[model samples]
Target: MDVLIVGGGLVGASLAIALERLDLRVGLLEATPPGALPAVFDERNLSFAEATVNALTALGVMQKLRAPTGAIARIHISRRGDFGRGLLEASRYGRDEFGRVVVARDFGEALEARLADATRLVRHRPMRFLGFAESGDDVRAVRVADADGERVLHARLVVAADGTRSAVRDALGIGVEEHDYEQTLFVTRVRGSRPPDGTAYERLTDHGPTALLPRGDRHYGLIHAVARDQADAVASLDEAAFLARAQETFGWRAGRFLSCGPRSTHPAIRVVARQAIAPRAVLVGNAAQTIHPIGAQGFNLGLRDALTLAELIADARTIDAGADCGSDTLLQRYAARRREDRERTIGFSDGLARLTANDAPLLRPLRSLGLFAVDRVASAQSFLVGGAMGYRGDVPALCREVRA
Candidate 1:
């Protein structure tokens, strides 16, 4: 096989699909069976950046979604006690929306549907990746197990998309830099008295942030953050109590939170792999970096990792049919190209998570000033908009194009 992907979740599946146009054979290993859903594809609502939606649409993944997606036409940012606020309208940039929102489960289904049509793609389902059996100069042998038993699969390149605690990464002897923010994020769907008008609200406070994203069904995706110690108490709250607490944290901006769906909690942590490549293997998505969810940049950033790697592989093969896809030069190029975007995005989300959580008296003035500048300054808004739309450094070909 030219390439073997170790995780058939969101990013892994995307990478496989992105390479479908190339004349190389590809394989995907999924631990879950054909009908079982992986934990990664849960009830979480994902905010797909403009570039991400465009790339997915180009790859024919978005067209297969069986559900509707909500558009983010406007963004509102503010602090709890600050009188100043920052607002951005997509129309100001001559676009109808900055991005779209979709449920993670639905997006996973769309990926599966698209993968079904990949003529050159092979799938190994209910398969478990044991470890690397042998690492040769041009190819690597990976040990995998299934109902039939254990066997070795050789591929010129191995891409790890298992997740944050990736076993594949561990076997590759890669170390990760981890930071626990000591915060818990609770996510669910809610109905506000005032229906969503395409505006997404992000209210930051001392504890954490309260975010409300518009949904397609006249509802909103709510994300409430609190100190880790209070997670149990928050999760145990009744529906009425939860709605009341959500309203209190978010204020009356979106009117009262009348109803809410099931609540889910996640720890706010940042994980970054020390390196993106090892021998003939590479890491993408959460395996490369699992960042805070403050800006909803996790999956979008991961998708970019997938698309960029796919683009590089395609270019290399085009230049030479027998080009070594797992060559040291190719891996170095991938690492060099991905560094800027990875660092900036991880820093952006980590900085926000820490900055907003810090209630230091002196920093309050600085925070207020920063918000003021972003609100009043054109350049500041442009920078924010650019990052929000996923136009950061070394973009892939598919993400560079936008259509109405």
Candidate 2:
């Protein structure tokens, strides 16, 4: 196989689809049981930037989603007791929306739909990637096992999308920078007094940061952060008590909280791989970096990783003579190209998470002033809008709009 993609999730599957246009054979290995999706596809809400929506559309994944998506027409940002607020409205930006929100299962279904038509792609399900061996051609001999037994598959390059605790990443001795934020995220479907108005709310409270993302069926996806010690208490509350607590934290600006769906808890930890490229392997998606949900930047950044690498691979084969897809030069170029975007995104999300996760008395006034600048200062607002739209220094091909 020209490329062996591990973890047939969103990032890996999309990458495979993109590479099929090239003159190469591709193989994908999924660890989950046949007919079952990866564990990441759950009830969680995925807030995609405009840039991500464009990339997904170009890759044909968005056209294939089986579920409804909610457009974020406006975003309301505020602190619990601060009068200053930051508002981003679609109309002000000359677009219909800054982004869209979709459920994880729906996104997974879209990927599965695209994967179904990959007639030339090889698929190995219920398999595990044990390790790999260096080949004479400077490629990789990947060892994978299933119920029938084990086999070595040779590929020009190996892409690891296995996620945060990636087996391939571990085997490669890749170090990760990890942070235990001592906060747990509680997620659930919540309803307000009235139907959602195409608006999302990000409220920073003394407890932690809370967000209400507009969802289909006039409901909102609730992500509430709490101290590690209080997470159990929050999740154990009855529907009435839960709604009351949530409303108290978020206030009545969105309206009275009426009810909530079943709740789930996730311990928040940020993980970023020290390096993304090894011998003949590269990490994408959660395997490359995991950030807090403060700015909803995790998946968008991962998708960028896949798209960037796809372009690099396509260019090397078409533009260079005797091109080696997994050679030192190709991998080096990939690393250097991704460094700036990775660092800036990580720092941006980390700063937001840390700033909103705590209520420092001394910092309250300054935080309010910053939010004011975000709303009142044109330059500050433009900079933030650019970031929210996923516009960076090195733009991806699919995300760029053609000029008339």
- lDDT of all predictions: 0.91, 0.85
TM-score attained by model 1: 0.98
Tens-digit lDDT track of model 2 for 1-404 = 77899998878888888877677778899988868889778888889888889888887888898778888898889988766999988889898888899888889888888888778888889899999765676678988899999888998889999888889899889999999889889898888887778888898876567999998768899999888999888877899998888888888877889888878898889999999999888999889998888878888888888888888988998886457778878888888888888988989988887886667688888889999998889898888788777776576797675221
Candidate 1 off by > 4 Å: none
- TM-score of every model? 0.98, 0.96
Task: Give lDDT: candidate 1, residue 278.
Answer: 91
* lDDT of model 2 at position 365: 85
Q: Which candidate is the best by TM-score?
A: 1
Give the total clashing residue pairs for model 1.
Answer: 0
lDDT of 2: 0.85
For model 2, the stretches where C-alpha displacement exceeds 4 angstroms are 320-322, 401-404
- Say which candidate scores most in lDDT: 1
